[model samples]
Target: MKNKDPKANFGIELDESIQIDGVSATATKFGESFRGIFRWQQSFFKLVWKQAIIYYIIYVSITLFYSFALDSGNQANFDAITSYLARYTSSLPVVLLLGFFTSTALNRWFSIMASMPGTNRPIALYVASLKEDAADGCARVDLYIRYVLLMWLLTFRIVCKPLRKRYPSLMSIQAAGFLRDHERLLLEKHKEQPGGSSKTFPLVVYDWLNILLRDTCQKGYFSVANDFGRNIDAIQVLKKGGGNVIKFASKNVPVALIQAVTLAIYCYGVVSVLSHQIEKHYLTSVLSGYFPLPYALPFFFYYAWLKVGRIAIDPFGSDEDDIDILNIFDCHINGAMRLRNCYGVKITIPSTDRSAFSLS
Candidate 1:
């Protein structure tokens, strides 16, 4: 896992374990780093061990049934079935299916990360666009930024479980300053409107944001001929980004594809156990028994691969391996607060100054 950026995570005291000291720096130093296999959290063994144990249990039971319970006729029939399954397991197309599926999930994961909002972006633009005595511009921008953040939390809480828990309702959001009392009332009232649902409140917020932008522009904050609509464009970009995140969250990988891969893994596991046995010698066949060690290694890896794909397919989850969306939100809010105070500083330039490299 990569360390959380301390620059972004300023003023928020999170647990130390969440930010591992040297993951990014030491990752390429093979001998000194890459100790992930030894880690329990998000490790392959951690993900697949329970499944592996269950598989081995069933395998041992089958061996017991074969060795002690089966008569010669039944044993012969079992051998026939085993031989048949052995011939066809190689043709299961598992490698190709898993290869394609996992890669698609990984790509989607990165795309979602791309679409996620970094709150500092619009604030940066807003503070720069506004002019004032001292930092009045920054104060004016903060109000609009609050609405943007509120809109984000309103939409994302529905998609992100942890954020939902963090702000259980708009009332909690109001307490936290993202939502004002009148606005929360309006949001709740609007949710009951004929065309509006709970999820549509972001649009209401967006409409309000639009009104603010239009008013601010009409008042001549930016020169009408020059950079007037930049804030509008910023809002549109923010809206589109939020919409894309919701879009991805809504449209999931097809159930048929998930089912096919799941069935393939388990079916192969079942059939492999049926046929794959250790044999000391076969003609006079000495130790023909269910030695599951050979299966364990491959089973663990295959199952872990499938799980990795499954986790990546929807990286919004609260699992250890999933994206820490709560952290992102916290970082953005903190970064925005820090950025707000940083501008409107006085600077001086000397008109008579010459370049240091100038030779008179």
Candidate 2:
């Protein structure tokens, strides 16, 4: 039997207690950050304070006008006006509509993300299935794999505005070592004219991949049924993903729906402020003392919720809250490099252009 000393047991219990304390401290820190009122001052709100200022100015103007300037002596008149507005448009239904709209936008954002394939398992599977006995086979294999990855990058570059900005031209992509000089020349020559490089480059890469698969199958490097066929299907899957990404990028939430919901929120904020003013002027003195409090709290929450919904409406843009397209591209390139390393292949593309160094 293993020795079970009382002192050792006590030491183990003490270590567990210390770990629990650390976990509790972490939980407390998280709660403070998440529930902090100042959290709103930290995000995109910090960069664009003017818009927030306008909102608060309008709200404060209403409060000031009603609390002191408006005929507080005629409480019945103010009550009638606010009560009529509230009866015509209730805030609760508008809030419910906003919640539904936000949920819809969130669902679309998730669907777009799901459509964009980020993992390289299919690429690795295709590469690992191949076998080559001919001399310079590894070099050819490396070229094929690189072309596949470069095609993926180009596809995303077309769909993502930020990535397109990063590699604005074929020459820039070539300089990044993602495309060789001859390949760039070939792609340029194949262009019907001197435009549409983004769309044409992916097609060129697809053609090259198809040719490579044909040659490999004919040379007995791998069976068409087992490897080449599967790779073709995998390429089609990637193509479908690219198509879906483009479709999502091209489409958006109906402009009418967004405008309607936004209008409702703003109207509710105005009516709510009016309602609170009516209560302060006519209600009990105790409640009247916290006049702006009631108006401010609901307005702030409503504005924050609407802002979040707007951000979700287009999650692929250049906004601070949008998806990080560059980071996703980096994951693809890194995974491709890792796959090359796993196959014990070493290859280098000569950097003929130094201008891309700045682009990097």
Estimate candidate 1's alpha-carbon lDDT, on a 0 to 1 scale: 0.74
Candidate 2's TM-score reads 0.73
Over 4 Å off in model 2, which ranges? 1-53, 67-79, 89-93, 189-197, 223-225, 278-291, 344-360
Position 85, candidate 2: lDDT: 76
Query: lDDT by residue for model 2 over 1-360, one digit each (tens)?
Result: 012132232111122212321123444554654443344533545544564566566656655566677675555677678678767555356777788889888888878877875437555765676663556566765787678777877787766778888789888888777789889888778775667555767777888888987887787776345787887787777777777877786788888888888888778766765664334434653354344555556666667677778887776678766776665566556566556656635468876777656643
Quote each prediction's TM-score: 0.83, 0.73
lDDT of 1 at 23: 47
Model 1, backbone clash pairs (residues 3+ apart or across chains), number: 0
Q: Best lDDT goes to which candidate?
A: 1
Flag clash pairs in model 1: none
